[model samples]
Target: MLNGHEEQEGVNKFEEKDGNSKNYDESDATVDRHRKILHTDNLKLQDEYQRLQQQNNKLQLLLAEYFQRKKCESRFSDECTDEEKERCYHNTLAKLKELQEECVDQKAHFEDQLKKLQEERQKTEDMVETELEIFVVYKREILLQTMKRHGGKRVSLEDLDRLQQVEERREKELARVQLENIKLNMRFSKYQEKFKAHSIGVDGQHLIDYEELKMENHTYNEKIEEQKEALQKVKKKISSTTHTLTQVKEKLEFIKAENLVKRGSLMKLEAHVNEKKEALKNLKQSRDSLWLDVKCLRCKSGLLRNVDLLQDFEDHCDSNDALKEKLDYLKMRYVQLTQNCREFRRKVQYAKQT
Candidate 1:
């Protein structure tokens, strides 16, 4: 019977050794798997770091280009013609487009990385859960042993202190992350508001330009009508001049007939008296003075017509100058309005961020 008990004891010892070997094998395998995962995480982190470095380099380059453009624009602002200004705006628009595309790409990349990281975190958590379960069972056994030895005492003081420290650390990390998120949200809101105000200002400026153009068109139509009226007045003046010329010709013909008859009479009277000859010469001189008066009237009428035309031209020039001044004022106002809108937008964005 003693040998039988000894043999049973030996069998029990061997079974215990087998159980320990199985536990050690599982523990080693789990540890190896965790190590492999950690190595993979390290490699991924390195790759991400390199990508971030590249992005930073690109950002720096973009900033440098922006500064260069600004400098160039500042130097040229006073001298820039309409076409040059347009070219500068076009270049800026193109750059904005490129930036938008880059932002989209970066957003996509970040989302993808986030997804990958979440998946890895989930897997890691699962592994941790399994390990924790094993540890919990081991700890339960140890706790039971400790309770038995110490008459139901609780956990060690050191362990409690460590747990409190861990909790505090986690709380701090969460708070930090939340604060960062709040800041980002605020900034995003600010930017959005700024963009809205800018857009509204642009719309308002466009409306003003449209109104100005309509007014300009109306003024041009009025000018055209005035020009037509002036042309009609000129035509009327020409017709009156033609009629006067015809009357002058008729008067000249009549004077010639009268002179011929008078001369014949004078020839008959010449045999009677020299006094009658002096009276005939005086009448011829009066006829010559009357012709000079007619010529002077025609010259005076031509000078009046020229003066009227010149006055009309001066009036048109004055109107043009007034229109140009109004246009310049409108343009200046539009620019100011746009600037104000931009500032409003920036403020709104800042408010939203806050």
Candidate 2:
């Protein structure tokens, strides 16, 4: 009775092991299905990452092309950079400053020359007045001498003639002094008019030119600012693209780690399942051999009424058939899942292309 009880316990333990192995097999199949799904998802993510990279490259190329076009089209900045703009502005400012300085210098030069001319005119007028005083003194002396010689009597015609000749000479000297004064006044007037006209025309024209330069510079600055804004927008787009790519890469890494773990677990489960199958096969073979030996003994002894061994063996065979059916169902489900994943990938690709 104890032997039969121990044998029954062993059968129960074997059934429990078989049931546990069946559960493990089912769980492993589910894990494998999930792993495949994850693998497919990882592939999709990689494809998306590649597409984003391509888009980023295209954006970069477009940005480069735009910058090249701007450079070719621009007239202000040489390199289209901020420093270039500043340098150009400085050069323009320097030119304006030089022009202003030149105008100031010219005005100063004109003023100095005018002051010298005025001083010379004043000197000439003083010299003319002194010469006239000397001429009057000489005439008075000659008349006093004539009066002394005649002694208040009638004067000689010859003496009167001499006075007339001296008078003529003094009048000629006065006329020459007046002519030089007139010429000096005319020259001063001409210079003053020329200075006035030059200042008006040159200053006005320079001021107009400077204003035009400023307006052109203003327009150039506006264009530069607009280009800068455009560059900033492109940079933002590139940054966003890079950020998305980084996220995808992280996701791919996570998927790879998960795949490694799942692969390890699947291998372990497969090893366990194979061990269980070997054990079951060995047990079935031993049981069948024992059953044959017992039948041979019973037939030889003429005691062929025992059918428990055959019935027990048939029950174990039926259990194995049920397990095989379950395995087949799981495999069919895995195949369906793989098909579904493939279809999903195809749909995604089609959508992206459209």
Candidate 3:
């Protein structure tokens, strides 16, 4: 039973480690995959950029030539003789044919480049998938090696804590690396967008032959008619806008007049408020003075006496009561003496009579 329990404990420990290793391995593989993808993407972009830059330069030169020709024609159109005009016209036609041929060649070349890029992307995806599988197998090998090294013993909590601390430090380093990766990704994305925009600017989807050219001319005429309609609409809009502006101007003038009247009324109200405030101030001052006079009257009328003096007056009243009691005793003594004297006199008379 004890051996069985020990084996179970070992299995449980192995399970915990397997879970951690799996998670860590998965994360590492993802990071590696991202790295490889970015590297391949960068290579692809470099090649594409070189090609596109060359094409752009050629297109720019062609555009410059055409524009230069147009400028020369405009400058000399009135002065040039018919033979010179005919020569210039022939030269222009030849240049146009050459430009059309170049355009066709470019379109074909671009199609080939597109095919190559698609194949490369597919190849890259396949390579990444295979590499991922290899990485997973490599991760498993490392885990097996780790298990061999650790043997069947259960990992202690203290050891796990130490490992967790180590992992935290590693995570900090990983985070810094991820930050740099993110910055690089941002730059890459910006470049990608710029490349896309550049490609759009020089798009090859235009009239390639005489029929298409004629269709384009017809479209231009239709566009001109649309523009004329748009211009009429704009004129109507302008007239409506002018009417609204006049109404706005009239309303503004009315508002300004009303504002002036309001300002006059406000000024009057403000003056009245100031007068009331001054009156209130005067009233407050008067009330304060009256309070001071009332306090002085209270003091002078002896309504507010000192506590010690009141106590002394009470003591004096108490002494006066004691003196009054003594006087009443003395008067009683005298009455008693008078009554005794009368009795003695009566007794003496009785003795004499006997």
Candidate 4:
């Protein structure tokens, strides 16, 4: 009877341990399932973020294109024909209307999406809080059962440490997830603000009165006609100026060639004057020697016999007069050349300024 009781007690303890182990396994499985669901939610959020970013980029591009088109239309308004301008204006109006409609649709869709996200966030929060509470209660029950089985002895230090560590990790993870959700909400709000701004800009155009736009259009047409007339006059003036410029260019080229020839002639004249000066120096020296010879002859024989000396003196005087005239002519020519150079330079400068 004593052996049987001991066996029964051992079996009961074994069964209790088995039940505890099974409960732990089930709890672990539940935690793993919750983790998987959270992971999926994170992935979905990431995908949504990427999608929103892409949409934002596309919207920015469209807005930029719209502004560029508007600028181009404004620039060409005066240049375009009346019919073309009207067509462009109609097209722009049509596009604006379409964009307004699209904005309305997008706004509605975004509002719906926002509402859905809010509801989903609330549901997720509620579910997570409930699950956490349940998990805590389960843990407490397990701890109590463990203590009972151990006869109220202190729980193992390693198990207590592990439980504390797991709870800390879970709390940290929950905080991180909450932070992420808050950040996502902030981003959504920013997107909403942007949408509001866009809608306001689109609607602002409606404030302009139609009568005022018509009057402005009429004034623009009158201005365009005036501008066209001015442009035609400018074109005529440009053509006349171009013809004058071509003629001046031709004259400048001719003057440059003539100046080159004149410079060559001036160079030749200078060389000739140098040669003449050298000849005059030689003639003076010869005359002086001849005079000395005549004086010596007169002193020795009391008379001079050479008649060529007087003739040579006469010829030297004539040559000196000719050289003086030639030098004066060269000086006049140099002055004329310099004046012509100045006049040509002035004309070239005037042409360039024009």
Highest TM-score among the candidates is held by which one? 4
| TM-score of each predicted structure versus truth | 0.34, 0.24, 0.30, 0.36
lDDT of 3 by residue, 177-209 (tens): 444544444444444443443444343542233
lDDT of 1 by residue, 1-354 (tens): 224345345345434543564675577578568856855774565556445545555565556667777887778678768898789779978987897788778768877886887688678767866775675455344333323323433543344344445545554554454444444444444333433333433567756655665565566556556655655655565566457445644654464455456556555665556787888899999999999998889788764657778798889999999999999999999999999999999999999999
Off by over 4 Å in 1: 1-21, 39-43, 46-61, 68-72, 75-77, 139-354
Q: lDDT tens string, model 2, 209-301? A: 556655655665565566556556555655664574466446544644554565566667778989999999999999999999988887886
Best by lDDT: 4
* List of clashing residue pairs for candidate 4: none
Q: Give the candidate order by descending lDDT.
A: 4, 3, 1, 2
2 against 4, candidate with superior TM-score: 4
In candidate 4, what are the lDDT values of residues 1-354, reduced to their tens digit? 124345345445444554565665576567667656765665565556556655655566577768787788778767768898679779977987887788678767866776776677666656666766666665554444343333343554455445556556655655554555555544554544444444444545423433444455566556556655655655565566457446644654464455456556666777898999999999999999999998887878632455687678779999999999999999999999999999999999999999
Residue ranges of candidate 4 with Cα displaced over 4 Å: 1-24, 81-87, 110-114, 117-121, 144-162, 169-354
By TM-score, the candidates rank as 4, 1, 3, 2
| lDDT (Cα) of model 3 | 0.61
TM-score of 1: 0.34
> All candidates: CA RMSD in angstroms?
66.0, 57.5, 33.7, 52.1
- Is 2 or 3 the stronger prediction by TM-score? 3
The candidate 3 region of ten consecutive residues with least summed lDDT is 144-153
Greater-lDDT candidate between 3 and 4: 4
